[model samples]
Target: MPILPPQQRTDPHPDRTGVRQAEAALVEHYPRLVRLAYVVLPPSLGRHRRVLAAHAVVQRALPAAGSRVRVPRVPAQSRRSGAPQGAEPAPEGAGAEQGPSGAAYGWMRLRVLRAALAHERRPRWWPGRLPAPAALRPAVPVVWGLRLFPRAGGVDELALDRALSTVDGAVRAAFALQLLEGLDASGARELLAGAAVADPGDAVRRAARLGRPDRAGARAMLWSGEFDPCTVQTRPSDLLRRRHRVRAVAAAAALCVVAGGLAFAVDAGTRPADDGRGPAGVAAPALDPARLLRTSPDRWADTSRVDFTAWPARGGRTDDNALLGRALRAWAEPPESVRVSTTPGTAAVPPAEPPQLLFADEVDGAAVVLFHDHADRVVRYAEPLSGSGGAALDFARTDDADVTTGAAVVVSRTADAARFLLAPWIAESTTRDLLAPDTPGRPLEVDPDGVTAAVPRPGAGGACDAWPVIQLRSSERIVEKHAFLLTDLGEPAPTHLTYMPKPGRGTPARQPREATGPDALLAWARTACSLRALAGSGVRSVNNWAFAEQKLPEGGASADWVCTRADTWRGPGRVLVQFLAPAASPAAPAAVVADREDTALCSKFGQHVLAATHWRAGSGRWYVLGAGSRAVTGIRATGAVRGAAGGPTLAVRAPRDADVELTGSLSEGGTLTAVH
Candidate 1:
């Protein structure tokens, strides 16, 4: 038989009543606090870690033995004994004089939430150093504890868990608080905002959709088992020893490096020249055919290679033609100086073998050639032409070597006989749509070899109206092509185009669908309403009082609602819908609207309103009433408003004392009417 240790005795400390009260609160609320912790702690932390974190939170918040307990604030009872005007009466069972316990409970809950959020943000270093209490379980399994009813048929627990896992931590927390704790979106946002959650409203909305569970079941399954009171069993002495060991090691390492020298040394002799050319006598590597074709002219040159040809001509009009001329000149020059070899006494050196031709084609009167030299460089040369040119002035090259084997060419046979060759890698099977609607020339043929041209006969518009024939000379043959007529070609060409590599075969992920137009927005509102109903949330009209009061843009569409029953777990829900017509669709009206609703049984007090109206065309005017004496400034209409025969005017009126402000474009030129 083992000898028993002396019995432990409580200290005879002051504030015994406070200690007992704190103990009583802890005993009653510990389980709920643990549940909150399970939801708030990062899901990445295992069940044991979550339980440990929850216990730590409670230990930090609850009053310690022999500690002073502060009294909680309680609302004063009415002196007259009857309910005051516009004030709600206390419940029948409620005491006339209540202790601070209610307020203390709220504070404790908040403290637990705050502590959980802190743990989520900065997890403990040694989460599993101490064993977790067996009674605690992860909140996920008991998430149903917050639900009013069991999951509906076809609701998979595993799937729900996966969906929750996909949501961001902050969003999950906000969603859990709203769904499990009955917090409104605004309240959740406030709590999370203090913890530095970005876009709390957005997070809440995302969570609401992702966390929705089927609602076809009856009573929820209650968690059984007695929960043990949270107790702190952290070994501070062991932690202190570890900290001391780490500090000693760090100090020793610091001492060892105190007199160390810098590891790197500068060597000017080893540095490359400012021009980036290799050292003297080092021959540049032979250009690989693939590499040369993919390299851009600018990358090959150290300095700007803009001064090779005189085709642009000084004082020439600064237009696409001039730019194309400059580009052609740059392509003709090489970055490295060409090495010449000859007998010491010979005065003449044979011209280097004509560049090995890779491909050739003719556009208008210009001859385009793609060729490479032994120096491992490729050049695109456009032969000088006499006629006016009509080709678009854009150029593109492929940076990828793997796909640079092919070439593309665009040809026009219309009055504007234009032709151009694309870089090899950019070129593929010829039949690509190279001309935009506004492009000067009409496409005749596109092929990998190069574009052929169709010559134009003389027409009324002088030589400019007539398409010319372009002659191209290849090693084996001379090719002739007709060119497009060159006229009205002074406008700047569109920027170059790039083709991204195709993605590998796989099912693409689905993105959340958003409503873009008025019709779509209304439809979205209906769908959201349906979803709310399915989750047992009552349906309300999309155009309710909150919506009718705001000055939405003319022809614009918007949808807003609150989703309380968004998930199986009962919670307050809120949604905001705002839409604007595409900026490119000027004729379309731009509209915005903001609406708020609480789906919970107990309604929350507050309203959010946002609205904007499309501007009217012409010199029209409008006025806003019911929004105090604020002036309605008019905005200029952009793009045509579709179907507004004479540019319709607008008028709006609201209560003179309503708390509303107009933003964005306002309608103009309409009768001032009161909004009744």
Candidate 2:
């Protein structure tokens, strides 16, 4: 390219060819721009900060890179900063050459760059005005350190990748392009083929391609999961795992996204449509389960997002997985826009369907229906719940204390003149049950709240039934069964428990202190169920659950626990048993036991169930109703919600206690063979 003198040039915007000086400027300042970016970062951040700041500035500069504007001509005889055009008249009086993303920084640009860098914590410049060149002159040493030895001021590939893990796809792409591939915005997009991004290029095709059946990659990209921004890691499962909304896009658009490689996705949603009717492809936006919940308007909004799908049963009660539901209700948001299919007579409430049977409490007149399921016992989770595939079972309140004694999830369907309450129960009858060879840790006694806490084996209590004792620390003197559970993940060892004591031990106390601190909570549950000693043996798949509620007794209240335990197999199975000390006061640890049984009842398997109800003051619903593996066990109430039209909707949610397994041969008459 031939160089032109300041006065000899016709237009200042072209490269050496006089085509348009805009692009030439970008290329000329490319290295300087990257360096300038590093300069504008906080010095305290030292090196890594330089990389991050550089990344952001360049990305912001990308969209503005192709712009063109008028420039004042500088005398060719002068330095790169050029002599002030105002001081020396143009030979032809033509304007000075211009550049892409041109700021008023020629030689003074260095000072302005340095100033911007120094003031990085707050870098804002007026339109067109650039920072003082003198400012950057002072940063020359830092600049030298960065370039010559390059002491970590430039983009460290590893660090950049790590940082992008938490950032959004667009920002991530932008960083990847400029930092990784060293491509400009135009170059990057050309590389990414309009990725399912906000600024995707060549819109219409990209939009259409998003939902296209054959494009697996596009689908994956569309369902981007929420990532903690500070972390910068990409979550591949975000998209697919979300409540999926269906929409489609074309292959051409998808191709663009794949090619653009970066910022092109930013312009994605803005493309023109084929029908020239609607917008480009409709973007299937992913909802942030965390943030949305945090930003909910109602004070009592749900505070978390629970993938209850994980611990379906008791592996179950430790945490409240209903936070997301609470948040949705807090924000007056529905889990699913519509839960019911339009039948012949029902009116359609587009985009808002209450599950045919859900617990909706009206807030300021708006319906806040959040449904949560509490099982009587923990068992193999072979199915999903609360959504489409889930059946809604609404229960009317009754004042019962025993979970096994009351009705469980009885749904009533009304016909022309009759209504029937459906249940999984047969006539109540007591019969000989079975169990498996015993191991360690007395089967948990359901706690006061229908749960049991497994305090430390006590180094004291002796090694847990040999499987492997997982130890945990706690603040109480007792142990419960439900406080711990056995799973096949990781090292199959007995993980210990941590329990806090009930309040009011010293002064005349009010209500029992919350059974928090993992151990104490476990103990509270353990106190309910009784635990019988198990002989030598490792038990197979088994589950348990309990429900707890206060019973009006002498001076205060009483506690009860119902346990439902069962194995997840079909052949010959063993049984494990445990319970709390009935004679123990409101504040003692429960006991446990395991046994082997014959002729399996429902598929040779071991299982347990526990439930309870708060005996209504007048209706008199007493007895902790519960059942286990076709065997109805005793029970108690967990919690309650206000019911509809009738009375309070009592939640006879089951157990909070731990689990136990037995290891021994079936032919053995359940001998208490000490493993040691």
Per-residue lDDT of 361 in model 1:
44
Off by over 4 Å in 2: 1-9, 12-22, 28-237, 241-323, 331-676
Locate the minimum summed-lDDT window of 10 residues in model 2. Answer: 428-437
Model 2's lDDT to the true fold? 0.26
- In TM-score terms, candidate 2 sits at 0.21
Tens digit per residue, CA lDDT, model 2, 243-336: 2322223544674566566445557765543321111221212112221111112211221121121111111221333533343332222244
Candidate 1 ranges with C-alpha deviation above 4 Å: 1-22, 66-101, 123-155, 193-205, 213-676
lDDT score, candidate 2, position 286: 16
Error of 1 at 12 (Å): 13
Q: What TM-score against the true fold does each predicted structure earn? A: 0.25, 0.21
Q: Per-residue CA lDDT of candidate 1, range 463-541, in tens? A: 2212121212211111122111111111101011111111123433121121222333332322322222221231111
